[model samples]
Structures are given as structure tokens and as C-alpha cells.
Target: MTSQKLNTFLENNLQELKDNGLYNEIDTIQGPNGSEITINGKKLINMSSNNYLGFANDDRLKVKANEATDTYGVGAGAVRTINGTQSIHDELEAKIAEFKHTEAAVAFQSGFNCNMGAISAVMNKNDAILSDELNHASIIDGCRLSGAKVIRVKHQDMDDLRAKAKEAVESGQYEKIMYITDGVFSMDGDVAKLPEIVEIAEEFDLITYVDDAHGSGVMGKGAGTVKHFGLQDKIDFQMGTLSKAVGVVGGYVAGTQNLIDWLKVRARPFLFSTSLTPGAAAACIEAIDIMSSSTEEHERLWENGRYLKAGLKDLGFNIGDSETPITPCIIGEEKLTQRFSKRLTEEGVYAKSIVFPTVPRGTGRVRNMPSAAHTKDQLDIVLETYKKIGKELDVIS
Candidate 1:
């Protein structure tokens, strides 16, 4: 029997969420998540996965992973501070630093943990973090963990960031100030004004941090957003994930050798958790190698994105201003957005609806992530389905 107090809390909160149309109903995918996926035995054109380059299902990655498992076994065996630091792990970290053009790099169990560990490791109550309002949830939690005064600057507003930086610096209330932002804003698919951000960082002598989770292998010809702007040396922290475009499961912070060394000892996740599997580490290295060697996947991704975006726009859907391939079909009402997503699924498309408080109330949308593996015909089918649904729902005239 469950405790009344605990049960009541769960039941009431969940009920409230459902009542407000904020409850998320998860769909079970039967097989690998790629350009196409099966849900409840129904195959759909997948537009909701972060497999930007389709590396997750690539045969090359599978071979590398299989080879690593055969050579090193499945798990890392222990926490990184113990016996988990395999040679492949070291090799992966070296490649991360090389790919990002940093002096050193350190890997973590996940991107969320990377932010949580890296932020708290360096920042403290003696510091202040000037974060963009649209920064990821992990970044928000990481700031809270740091015990620092977090000042939220307006999203992509350089003037506001500059003003906040000036005020934070002149206040003299903190010993150190850091400016952190997402290299690519996930929801709106817009890019952070990194050049302006770096200039402001220089003027304020602020530590620069960028979480390029969405930008890796998608921007800078697969290098990242920092490399996109050629401001890598100006930024202090470059955090990214191996799970997204890299097609593996891990995260890394690339910076100076001292920063990597400090994180190795100071980052709680690194010290407390087992390192990435040998297979994942090996696959990550090969993925980077593939990206560096050829631009086929990168070019294919952008082509698909442009094709999808152009088609959506031609159909009179509001895709917003996306600098990346992430497309959002903005629907004004939460319930309507959910219904639209349902309709899309019914029509053999698998785009997910995002509503408040994920994207602010009344600005709900069906977020579409087009991957490189999607054929033009598959995308056209998606487009045709979307058009029918939009017309049926009166979302477009």
C-alpha cells in the first residue's frame, strides 16, 4: 500500500497537469530511432529525432561499436576515478579537443551531468552567472547548484547582456562573473549572437561558456558553433554531447588543459560516475573521423532541412526563423497544438508537439527535426500529410 501523503502529491499534481493540458503522453518506439520509426507497430516518417546526421543507424558506427565491445567488453567497469578510464576514453577526449580546436577536453556520462558538474566545479557563491533567458534546463539547474547569483539576460539580446554584464561587474558583489548561452537555441532554432557575446565577454573580462549541444556536427561544417564564428579561443568553456549529432551517448567539455584537469578532479559526475562505454567512446571517435573526412552527411543534412523548410513555408505553415534545421510549426493554442500533432501521427508523421511551459503558453508548436537519412520522397510524404492535417484543422487557409 502506498503512503497517502506521497500518493496524494503524485495524483494531485498529475491530475492538475492533465487538467491544464500540460501532461505529456509518451509513445513507445519499437525499434531504432532513425529517419523512420515504428510506434505501436505503425511505421511513420520520423521528424522528432535529434539524429541530425543519421549517424545513429550508420553501419560504420555499428562496426566500430562492435569492435570496441569485442576488444574492451561492454562497460567501463567502474567510475572514472577508479578503473573506468579506458584508453578509448582518453582517445575520445583527445579527439573532442582536436575537433573543437581546444587544448584539452574531458568527457562525462551525459550532457546534463556535464553541465551540472562543470558549472558547480568552477562557479561558487563568490561568483555570478549571466545566463541567457532561453538557456537549456540543465544550464538552469547547473547555475542553481553553483550557489552563484544567476542573472538572466534577455535571449539573444546583446545590448541587454552588455548592460547586465556592466551592472554585474560594477556592483562589485562577486569575485567572478561568467556569461553562458546555448550556441544554438533549440526551440526557435536560432543561433546565439556569439560574436557579440565574445566582445562583451572581453569588455567585461567575463568567463565565456557555450553549450553547443545542438550545434555540434550541424554547424561549422561539423566542427561547432564556436568554430562557425571562429571565436573558439575567445570562449572559455565549450560543452557538447556525443548523443545528438555524434550518434553516441556522452558529453564533453573542451577547453584549456588546466580546465580539463580541474574538471577531472572537481566535477562531481566525473568523480562519482562510471565513464562512457568503450563501444560508445570508439564510435564517437569514428563519427568525428567520418565528419572530418567528408562533408557528404553535413551537406545532406542542410539540403534536407532547406527542402523541408521551403516546403513547409510554401504550404503556408509558420516555421519561424530557424538558423538550424529544427523546424517549429507554431500553433497558437496548447490543446490545438497537441491535436495537430495527433493528427500528424494519424497521418503517418511522427513530429512531437511542444507546449507550455516548454515554450511559453499559447505559443505551442509541433517541433520537426529533419535528419540527413530522410529521402526527398519521405519528406514529401511528410509534407503532404502536414498539408492535409493543417487544412482539416483549419491551421492554414
Candidate 2:
């Protein structure tokens, strides 16, 4: 039977969240997630997906996925350590390594698991991790799970990172030290200062890891943020996801052959969880090939981002300091932020509100993710709706 205490705890917390406008109401996308989406049978401009290159529903990827599915069954039979490692999985890893300019790579079931497994695999109670204060939730949890002493470095503050790194090393309490940060901060859309970060890492002999989940397929002509800074050889662990720009589902870490080999045997998620399905592996391979060969999608994505950002800025909306395509329309109050997003949906755009926990309280925003699939006409409509909603809601005057 359900525990009575559990029921009471859930009831109280759920009500409190709703009352405070902290509760997120998930919208059901009735069709393929693309430049436009359908929710509750109504069509809306889709600006809130990680499908950066518009490859999520691309025919080429779908074709490859189908072929792989026909050749191999739906799921890998077991974990990679056992008999689950399929041929396509090997091909996918190789493709990832080549694309990321690394000697080798290892795949994970998801981006979250990739961080969880990779961090704990090499770090432990004897180590300390210096992480960006605004790093993704997965990175924070990974640091915690490693049982390491986690030091928070101020967001994009290289001076703070250097100080903390020196302190951690000089403390002499930890056996090893590592620095982890997101290649692209998804919220503000600012990128990590990789050149300075690498210099600091070298000075302190610290292992460096970059989780480029948003950067891949969107930066360095589709290679990622590390390559954007020409630091592929400098970073130790180059972690990324196939689910975002790759338009598939999986995560990977590309580095030296030895690093990947260690993760293959040591990362518990790889050892215990089932490998990615053959279809997904094949689709990921296709996506990497597309990224390596063409800049069409990548260029288009940037264009769309610029168009949207200019529109919002011209309309006097506070779109934070975004270096990438991710644009956020900052709305202060929680209820007002949620209301803004709702009004946007009613007016035909699908931008969603990001509140506290996702972002800091009082910094609530309507995060817009512009993809390559979006056309000028669609974006124009989105801007018009935004202008109307902005003035009406007093989010902008």
C-alpha cells in the first residue's frame, strides 16, 4: 500500500508549488517536434526544443534509423559489459571520435547518465571537483555522487576558478583535482571561457572536463565549443550528447584512447545499463556525417537565432547575454513569467517559462530555442506575437 506519510508530503508540496507559480505544466506536443508544433490540436511556432540543426525529424536520419532497425532488433539485449555491445554502437563511437577530433569515445544511455558515470568513474572521495556555479544540474549531481569535495567557482569568473583550484590543490587533502563546466551555459547562452580555463588547468595540473551538450551541432561549424576555441587536444574529457543537435538519443565522452577504455570498464552506467539501440546508433552516425560534411543547417540555425534575438531586443525585451542561438526573454515575477509564456502560446508561439530551480528566482524567463528548420516567415509571426504580448503584459513598454 502507498505510505500515508508519503501521500501527505506530496499533497503539501504540490499545493505549495501551484500556489507560488513554481509548478510547471507540461504541454503535450501532438506531432513531430520541429519548427512548428501542435498542442491540444492547435499549431504553434516551436521555439523551445534542443533540436538545433532541425535533424530531429529529418528524412535522412529517419531513413538510416529504419535501416538499422531492420538489421538489428529494437533494444540492445543487455549491458555493454555483457553481450549488448552491437556493431553499430562501435561505429557510432568511432564517428563521434572523428567528429570531435579525439582518439576515442564511449557512449552512454543519456547525457545525464554520461555525467553521472564519467565523473564518478575517475573521481572519488579522495578527489575535489571545481565546478561552475551555474553549471547544469547533471554536472552538480555528478560531482555530488563522486563523493568529492565540490568547490563552486563563480559563473564565468576565471579569477575565482584559479583561486579555488589553487586552494583545492594546496589543501593537500584531496588526491586529485578536476574542473568541470558546461561548454555553453544553456540559460544565459554564454559560452565557457575555454582558453583561460585550459591555461588554469595547465598551471595547476588539473583534469578538465567540458560538457558540451548545447555546444555540439551549434558551434565550431558543428564540431562543438572546444573546437570553436581550438582546444580539442587540451581538454581531458569532451562530453556531449547525441540527443541535442545530433537529433538522436545518447551521450558520449571523447578523449584519448586510454580515457575511453577506462570509462568503458569503469563507468557504472555503461557497465550496468543497456547499450543504445542499433537504430539510434545508426541515426547518430548519420547525424555526425551530416555535421562533418555540411554547414547548411548550422548556418541556418545561427541566422534564426540572430533574427529572433534582434526582434526581442528591438522590442525592448531583456534577452540575456547569449553567445549562442539559445535566447531567453527575462520576466521577473514567477507568476508573470508563467503568464507571459501562456499568453505566447495563446497567440501562436510555443516558448515556455523557465522559473526558479531551472534558473534563479526573480530571474524567471521564457527561454526560446531557435532551430535551423525555422523559416523567416514563421519567425516573423513569432516576433509579432511577442510584441503584442509584451506590450499587453507590460513585460516591455
Candidate 3:
């Protein structure tokens, strides 16, 4: 309980992280997150941001944010349950519901908070959750917090999911069963088999949840994965982040009006946390407008992804089975992956390396997030640098 004792414990854990080369050092970005960014006074081709549609720095979004700030001031001032729920907040939620083609929607402070709030609110101690093995950390934590018996099925293994779902339902021990997955896997860039998953859920009468954090602005013609598979009516929870593809900061859950009503009443984060600012809410509404009106950004993002992935593949680098714009250049060792990232940075690219325990051992990678903002010339530069560093590090032949 002493300060010295706490310091010693922190030091020991910090030392462990350092020894494992997993100590995350925060890098300061001096400018906007875009195709190119400034970090530590150096400019680099940025492939690390989740700004899929480049709306983070977009003029339209900026103008909306400014106008909202001017009209409504800065903060919501209190939690949503109190006086924090502004008209803009309700408008944004309605827009999200419209965009995802759901009956109702509710917004939270962050995407992570939405998962932590919504999942725990619905599935309690008596319920059971069937989660994908590779689901996001937020989902894993949410499941744990729900006090539900969480059973992680193998990633994208429908056979495993079907067997587990059938067994769980037949057992009849739990009050409710929920099946959850990320619509698009972030690291490997593979998409969830939602069509098959939905079929299995229907057969077993399971509640369906899809966290489309990376898929919202990137898939289903910008509506999301549930929309992509035409399973909007089947899914119970269609979760997404306004911060990523939408280029604003917040999270939302779109579902039946009953579900949204339950979350507004029961979700802890919604009840206890302050709502999103007027500016963020307004910017998000504008973002959805842009997403619905044009497919140019989505098309360009896929084009860039194809260009980069093809170039890396032609150079004999192992670009994993990514069906989305997220491309990972898998390097076997942690040290090599880190070294690859460092080399890329020195050569003016900013793709980050992923190592254990973010990923499994021997699956370390330099993950690339190719955005709609990236130009052909920028991608060409990244490719040339990759080839140079790959040759030097022997990552490619």
C-alpha cells in the first residue's frame, strides 16, 4: 500500500515489457493523420491510421465541426442520462440508424465504450456468449464483463461455431445465447463470413452481434458488413466507430428500437459517461452524408490497397490473405518485424509492426492501412522503400 511498493511493482512490469521488446513508446504526430504525416519533425507516408476514407482532415467535416462548435459551444457538460443528450446527439444516432438500415441507434463516447457498455448491458450472468477467437480486445473485455459463460470459437471456423451454438442451445442452461464477431478482422484484413454466420444464428435462434469498427466506412458500400450480407434484419447488434472510417470520434450500436431503448436505460457507459460533443456529433452526421453520396473514396481505397498488395506480392513478400484495404506484410520473427518497421520509418514510410501479444508468435507483421487519401505516387514511394529495406533485411528476395 506504500508508494515505494507500488513503484517497485510498476518498475518490474515495465522491465518485463522492455525485455520482451513490447514496451510501446508513444510517437507524437505533429500534424493531421493522412496519406502523409509529420512525426517528430519528419514527414513520412502514413500507413498506420484507421482513417479509411480520409475524412479526418476533410474540409467538409472540418467546416461542420467548426459550425457546431460555434453554435453549441464545446462540451456536452454531463452524462447522457442527465442534461448531456443534445439534439445533435439524437440526430447523429438517427443518421447512423438510417445509414446501417436499423430500426434504432444509440451513440457512446468511443467505440470501445460502446462494446463495453452494450454487450454487458444485454448479456448478463445467466447468458452465454459465443465469440470469435480473433475478436477485438474490446469485445473480449465486454464478454468477460458481462459475467456470461464466454466460449471462443475458432476464427472463421463455421463448423466450430455451428457445433458450439447447437450444443449451447440444446443444453438449455443459459437464458440467452449471443454470437459475436468482427465484420472485418483488423490485423489480417480478412472479412467475417457473416452470410454463413447469420444462417447458423438463425438455425440456433442466437442473438447476432457484428462490430464493424473497420468495416463501417470501408465495406457494404459504406453501410457496413451486416448491410454487405443483407443481414440487417437478422443481426441484433450492428456496432461501429465514428472515429475510424467516418473520420470523427464516437461509437454507435444500431438495432431494433427495443434494443436501443434497453441500452439507453441499461448501458453503464451511456448512463455514467458524458455524451459526445456537439462538434463531433455534427461532423459524424456530415460524414454519413458523404459516405452515402459517393463511392469515390471507397473505390480509391480499394485501388490503393490492390496496388500496394500487388507490388509487395510481386516482390515475394508474404502479404496475407486480406480481402480489405488493410494489408499486412508478415515477417516471421518479432525482431525482424520491428526492424522492418524501423527501416520503413527511416525510409519515410510509417507502417507499424505487430508482435506478441497483439498477434500470435511467429506471425509478427508490418501492417499497412492504405487509405483513400493515398496517391499513386505516394504508394510508389512506399513500394520502392519497401523493396530497398526488404533487400537489406532479407525480408524479400
lDDT per model vs. reference: 0.94, 0.95, 0.93
Q: Each prediction's TM-score against the native?
A: 0.99, 0.99, 0.98
Return the lDDT, model 3, position 359: 92
Q: Which lDDT tens digits does candidate 2 get at residues 1-397?
A: 9999999999999999999999999888987999999999999999999999999999999999999999998988999989999999999999999999999999999999999999999999999999999999999999999999999999999999999999888889999999999999999999999999999999999999999999999999999999999999999999999999999899999999999999998999999999999999999999999989989999999999999999989999999899999999999899999999999999899999999989999999999999999999999999999999999998889
Give the alpha carbon lDDT tens digit for every residue of 18-56 in model 3.
Answer: 777676667899978888999889999999999999999
For 254-299, candidate 1 gives per-residue lDDT tens digits of 9999999999999999999988999999999999999999989999
For model 1, what is the error of residue 276's alpha carbon versus the real structure, in angstroms, after optimal superposition?
A: 0.6
392 Cα displacement, candidate 1 (Å):
0.8
Candidate 3: residue pairs that collide:
none
Task: State in Å the error of residue 5, model 3.
Answer: 2.7
Model 1 worst lDDT window (10 residues): 15-24
